[model samples]
Target: MTIIIMLVAALLPAVLLWLYVWKKDPQKEPTSWLVKATLLGVALCIPVAILEMGIETVLFGVDGGPTNLADTTIMAFFVAAIPEESFKLLALWLILRKNPFFDEHFDGIVYAVCIGLGFAAMENVLYVFNDEEWVTVAIGRALLAVPGHYAFAILMGFYFSIYRFVDKSPKIAVCILLVPVLAHGIYDSLAMSSIVDPSIGGISVLVLIYFCVKMHKVARKKLLALKEVDKCDNESSFT
Candidate 1:
């Protein structure tokens, strides 16, 4: 049917992105913990999604409530932004909080990115398979929403790395979660309000891409530094 075709089309982008990220990082083999983290993120999101829908339905009266600004704000802030970020952070924590591979600042970014991508992949499949207009929805999500999620997670990772390397403070992690929640909420509000112009959206995506690339460099640098330090330590011990 036409619906099936659309669904498949929609899944293509997500699949492609997943494959690309996986292939590009073959040095990083996935662990059982990574699978668990992905599952945790997905699981935690369910109740949060229910809460979002419930609040929206109550406020908007079941017709999308014409953007239902108040409800949307509630959904964005409390439901979508907060819960989602918390879950993603949980995913990161569950995997990396005390793991051996988490020896450098960059490891936070790597693990967090994996969690984000896993969540996005599953979520994308659901979207694409759930509707007849899946192709269009998929394109929109892939082009905008999915990348935004990844970027937000990357920010969390970046902060997590900083704190892990220096302070080891829980507050930094809390702030990491809040900052992304706020950004995600604001983005949802603007996106729903039609206030974000196409140019702005395009630029926002570009900016996110730039951030990812910059963070990649930061992660690589830290990793290399750690390797050098380890090498020196090994030599000194032998000498």
Candidate 2:
């Protein structure tokens, strides 16, 4: 029963977020490709975990100590954000690079969100099941962490679409990878800081919430703009 609850709590937000992003696309991607991207995302977590452990070991030594602000920032950006987002981007590229269905601009967001949610689902299960206070952790993650992943993916896809369809520049493609890493790093840094200082942590949470909300709005607007551009391109192609 506890395991069942854990699975449901872990997956519910991911499914809901997936559906929301899917519906935002004016022209949907192939179901098969989306499924593959998601499965790839799940698989990517294994490597990301291994890489992060190795990095953490190098940075903090085998025996971890109390985290200071410097340690938290370093862990957040280099250890967590860099490894995780870099691999996720690699997974995204592998899944969609040669696929014909990746035609529309909005498809980038759709597929990226799918991969992001896949990672979130796997990650949520691990955290929720491992913790003693499973319910509190589950609920908090459902609200913040899952949505946070979605926001990060949205930013990734937004820049990625521009890189793929608009600019096609190496710099823009690099931005596709870096933007999300920066966002994820700041997010984790703030969350990790609370471990050392609860007062500062409280402020971090509020700021995170605000940042997430703003990011979601910006991402949504970008999606809509891309959809419009796609529409124009389709009409022009016909004429």
Which candidate's lDDT is highest? 2
lDDT on C-alpha atoms for all candidate structures = 0.64, 0.87
TM-score of 1: 0.68
- The sequence of per-residue lDDT tens digits that candidate 1 reaches over residues 69-173 is 565566567656776777788778878866876765545665676677666766777787887777677888877677666666666776777787767688886
Off by over 4 Å in 1: 1-31, 54-71, 169-171, 195-239
Clash-forming residue pairs, model 2: none
TM-score of each: 0.68, 0.95
Candidate 2 whole-model C-alpha lDDT, 0 to 1: 0.87
Residues 134-238 of candidate 2: C-alpha lDDT, one tens digit per residue: 999999999888888898898888888898888988889788988899889988887788887777977888988887778778777877888889999989999
Q: Which ten residues in a row have the lowest lDDT in candidate 1?
A: 18-27
